[model samples]
Target: MKKLLYIDANVNRATSRTERLAQALLDRLRANEDVEVTTLVLEDEGLAPLNSARLARRTAGTAAGDFSDPVFAYAKQFAAVDEVVIAAPYWDFSFPALLKNYLELLCAQGVTFNYSDEGVPTGLVRATRAWYVTTAGGYCGDYDYGWAQVDALCRLYFGIPDVRRLSAEGLDIVTNDVDEIMADALRAIENEPL
Candidate 1:
């Protein structure tokens, strides 16, 4: 079965426009293939940030060739997925801290990636594609730091060759119709390649 990981970082939960758009995208993707979707709601996951102690444990575990800890579970799942979808609302030029924390745990050196013989970093993830979906109250334009960061990480670290982005911007603009904006985003999602 094709495994698709859905990482939800929408703090608003059910009321989030980004989440709605992401669901539409996922629905389209599912229709194109038989996929087993695993949803990780960051808000409900209670994930802790990587502190010094956690880092040290991870390092020690790697050096000892032991990955049986629960801390490495996320990285293991990430490496085995076939695709990834991250949905978040644009806040303060980025996504929430919860998503960052999740990424930190999943970016284990020996789990998600490793150094090659030439000293260059090589990706060990199995995912072939990833999509970052976000909603911005205002025009993101060239200042979309959240999407940019996710794109870079997917390509550089996760070995995901195809990375795409879906966004709905200007939802908070007084002159713009929010429903119309969302409808357009949904249409775009439906038309996106699976």
Candidate 2:
């Protein structure tokens, strides 16, 4: 079965619109009938932050020899997945730092990617596509730094060209048109052909 990795970074379970929308997107993707979904809520799983010890191990050439702990296991899990979906609310002009940390772990050299002559990167990730789902409080306008930047990183740095984004804005600002904001996000996910 094709593996689909869903990474949820929102900690607020009670009123997280981004999480809700992500779930909706996952449902739509799962309807394809050919994919198996594996959801990881970051808040619940408590991924370990990349510390000096981990860095030392990586630098000392221990990362390649170790697949015994959850940290290394997560990297393997990420590498084995067929697709990846990242869902996180926009915070301080970007995603949660924990998601970034998780990404740091998953984007390890010699695992997720390799470098050839002239230092050109070649990705080893089996996933042909990645969907980034997010929502922001204020309209980021032309300077949308949330998913747009993340998508680009996934494409350029990670070599995943099939990255797509679904977003909604002004959710934090209570307005009469709140329903429309949510409806648009759902439609965007529903309309995705992938």
Off by over 4 Å in 2: 62-71, 146-149
| lDDT string, candidate 2, 68-95, tens digits | 5455656678778888999998888888
Most TM-score-accurate candidate: 1
Clashes of each: 0, 0
lDDT of 1 by residue, 40-136 (tens): 9989989999888888889988888788877898999999999999999999888888899998898888898887888777889999999999999
Q: Which residue pairs collide in model 2, if any?
A: none
Question: What is each predicted model's overall lDDT from 0 to 1?
Answer: 0.90, 0.78
